[model samples]
Target: MDFKVFTIIATIVNFLILLAFLKHFLFEKVSNAIDERSNNIKNTIDKTNSDREEAKNLKIQVEENLANSKLQGKNIVEDYKGRAEKLFQDIKKEASNEAELIMERAKKDVEREKEKAEEELKKKVVDLAVILSSKALEKDINEKEHRRLIEDFITKVGM
Candidate 1:
């Protein structure tokens, strides 16, 4: 190759002009596009983290609601059990009172029947006594006189 001073200087000047043009037009636009893409990626990551945290909080709230529902169900069952026990006790007390009334009525009926039987026996004894006295005093009395004497004796004995 021929070593020419003027040609070397001209080539260096052309290369410097091309570098300045590329820096002003192509490089500047490319660098701005790359920075915009990096910013978009960072915003998407932050949004994804926020959505994941919201989902975790929702899951915790649902679990707490489930536990509260279970406790309410248990309380309802206990209330029903207590009401059933109270109803059973009331029925038992009513049955006991009815049985006592029946026993008292039975006792009154027995007492009335005993008194009626004693009165019937006393009337029979009175008739027997009158017959025996008439037989013992037979010879001393006429028919009309005997009847009047028996009436008088019965009146005195009744009093």
Candidate 2:
């Protein structure tokens, strides 16, 4: 071959060796670094999504607890109302019983007073009759006639 052609071939071989070295040393390391950065970004995104889901679950749990607490409060109020009604009924019954007892006692006291007054009246009537008979007998004395007059007075009085 010619001298010029030999120089051109050597220069082409040198350019190919330089391209191979650049591909092996610089391009591979830069590509690996880029891949590692992409993987880190993917991992961070997954972790953020997991955290958001956990927050959502916690909110739902809190709402459920609030609803349960409200139900419990309502139940407590109903229970108290029932208890109060029962207590009021018991008090009313007791008052009614006491009033009945007081009325019965008053009636018994009135009956006893009536019996006492009747006995006193009967005794007074007997005494007055004796006095009247004694005064009349001093003027006209017959024992049978006196007894008959007293018996007639007693029959007219009826007691």
- Predicted candidate 1 versus true structure: per-residue lDDT over 88-129, tens digit per residue: 999999999999999999888988888788666655555555
Per-residue lDDT tens digits for candidate 2, residues 1-159, read: 456977888999899899899889988998999999999999999989999899999999999999999999999999999999999999999999999999999999989988788767765665566567678555755656665666677769786
Q: Which pairs of residues clash in candidate 2, taking residues 3 or more apart in a chain or in different chains?
A: none
Judge candidate 2 at residue 112 and give its lDDT.
Answer: 93
The best candidate in terms of lDDT: 2
Error of 1 at 19 (Å): 5.8
- Show model 1 residue runs off by greater than 4 Å: 1-36, 120-159
Candidate 2: misplaced stretches above 4 Å? 1-40, 136-159
Clashes, model 1? 0
Q: Which candidate is the best by TM-score?
A: 2
Please list the Cα RMSD from the true structure of every candidate, rounded to 1 decimal place. 6.4, 6.1
Q: List pairs with backbone clashes in candidate 1.
A: none
Clashes of each: 0, 0
As a whole number from 0 to 100, the lDDT of residue 133 in candidate 2 is: 67
